[model samples]
Target chain A: MKKIKYILLATIIATIWGCKPEEFGPIVGSEENFLKEMQGTWSLTKVTQVDQNAVSNGWPYKQLDITNIYPYKELVVSFQGDASGKPSTFTITPGNSPKIADLNSGNWSVDNTKAPTVITLTNNGQTSTLTLGSYANLKNGKFYLKREKKVNGKTILVYQYEFTKK
Target chain B: MKKLILSIIFILSATLAFAQVTLSPATFTAEDEVTITLDVTGTPLAGTQDVYIWIFSNSDLPAEIIKKDGLTNGQWTNSADAAKMTKTGTNIFTFKFTGTTLFGQSPAELINFGFLAKTKDGTKQTQDYKPYKFDPLVFVPMQFRVFPSKMDQTDMTTVYFHQDLATDQNLQRMFDVKVNLVFYNDATPVPAVVATRTALVTVKESNILYSYSFIPERLITLTAGTKLTKFTYQFTGSVKDANGANVPVAGPVTEVVYTPFN
Candidate 1:
């Protein structure tokens, strides 16, 4: 009876150990962190107009700094988040300035959660995509986006926008 | 002996022509501020203590010699302080004025103007009046053009090509054209040149218009104290040879000068 009890106990312990799943490193959760970081108000700081032709030709000066040419400083943008901290609606309040984003409000999304290089905004089935500048560290309180203006599927001009977290 | 006398006369005439009044910017519109320099070495106004300018509209009153209706300076006998010339060097005096402001007329109203240097009392003056014609204020599209007319090293400038204005049949029908550029810093005694850069893509503005824009400082790394004084460019495209193979062709070389930033 004593030998049978020991055999049953060893079998049960082996079965429990065999059923245990493998463990790995912690989850990155980069998308959630970026979405959370972008959910806030941002103010327009600068706007630069880039000549696509000059850039394609490897010219040294493809951009024209026109930050103070218009009333761009009055523009403010807000990126809202849902209850789950996911990217949701995006809004722009252009005070005495042109609607650079083309839409006042729209649903915003990133191309990838892990490495988001592009941000797309959709309004009434019309979508516009902005290339995120390479220097975007969401925690640095600064953001840059490049909007390329195209005609007949050919890029003609690119406008760069810089924003500061308010 | 007769031939020698004729040669002497020709040389004397050339010297007189060289000593006449000259404009700083050979070409200018009425809106530009121009400086006129006069070499009064052989003229009656030479060695004058206080020289003055007497400018008149030659286009408005063709029959009149001295019509000063819109003159900004005081009367010819008593010149205004504004009309006084600054002595730059021996026998050389310079007077700066804007055509529009000097004549108190719009750019459209002015055409040709005549000016002469004289003593303050108007007793001694240049022998003949010097005439200058203003550049057309109207915008007439050309085969090639540069934007803003005035450019600096740090400012963005654009060079444009108009197919409609192209004189060459091949250029008018060109496709996939590109610009070739070379920069030169001629501000110093010896000119510093940047390497020739070809294959600059052009952006199409319309069916017949294209342009390439760039900043000098960004395109070329200038050595310390080097100024971008001038640039030359040409449009290149490919054309079909007799065997139907594509061959490279280039348009006329165009040179543009840069203005100094204040």
Candidate 2:
């Protein structure tokens, strides 16, 4: 009976050890935490492009300066208070060309249901996603989303919108 | 020697013919809509004879007018027909060429127009008219509409403007209009994004005032997180010369910064 009790204790210890602490800030790893933190308004200023394979091949991604490409300068976005990246919209006043409306209607979701999690934005029936890393590892004052695209004699503009919380 | 003497006499006659008419405002701006009075009343040319005026850039002069009896430059009229002087009154003729479009050149560029009285068949001819030179005025934005001259607690700074061609030059032809902005907290620019044209001034204009507003959030918060109180901005108007160099119509005009949440 004592041996069985020791075995039980050991099993409990192993199980507790197997579970890890939050990788981010207070109460990390919970999708709920990540979503809640994303609720406020964040201004998107920059978008960059990268070639992952080219990094090893000596060519890396470049940050695109689209400030002058106008029609749209910065995007002010707000997420819902809940874990759902929903009930959110972004405002952008255009500058030069490729005009985008002032308000872009969209729903958002974090796909942590699989490897290489992503946050997808759906607007006007079109969906765009950004790959996610450790949510807790997010640098204060800014957030980043990354993706991979194939170029078949076509252009692949990997947009990385640098955000500042408002 | 006889051929040389004939050539000299013909040249002299052509010079004499050129002196037959008086062109007022010998130098005019191409973009301006101005009236030019041409006095050929003193000349002996017949009323049936036409006075052809050919406008050309400085690059194209010593035209083929006398050589091939055709213009080496463009016509003054924005029409299929050439711009021929008309007898408005007596021997006095008038030639009014509207905006720079007639010369197919941008503002601030020089154009030369010469005149010669002759029929299309070279039947009745006058000497080549001395070249008339003009430098088109560099258009400037008539009035700048920097609204709210102050900012309210909004996410954007709004500006309105309407360029009237009748009162002002076409905004599109003017140089890029930039906004110089500096956000300050306590009368000091905490972080300088100086000489920033944060506001994208498109060439689009209308008789009715149009406007655009952008969030000054970045100009204030871009450097370090500082709560924005106010910002100072100015308007710098300019235009490009014939060589594409900026020619300032007016220096930068400073405007009072806006108050947020006011």
TM-score of each: 0.51, 0.28
**How high is the TM-score of chain B in model 2?**
0.34
Native contacts retained by candidate 2: 0.00
Off by over 4 Å in 2: A1-28, A51-56, A60-73, A82-103, A113-116, A133-139, A147-149, A152-157, B1-262
Superposition TM-score, candidate 1 onto the true structure: 0.51
After superposition, candidate 1 runs with Cα above 4 Å error = A1-166, B1-27, B39-49, B58-78, B121-138, B148-150, B168-170, B174-176, B180-207, B229-232, B236-262
In the predicted model 1, the residue pairs found to clash are A60-B218
Interface RMSD of each: 13.6, 20.2
State the DockQ, from 0 to 1, for candidate 1: 0.02
Kindly list the per-residue Cα lDDT of model 1 for residues B83-192, writing each as its tens digit.
Answer: 88899887888888878888877777777687777787788888545457777656555899875455556545678889889999889877788999999876432356
**lDDT (Cα atoms) of all candidates against the true structure:** 0.75, 0.48
Docking quality category of candidate 2 according to DockQ thresholds: incorrect
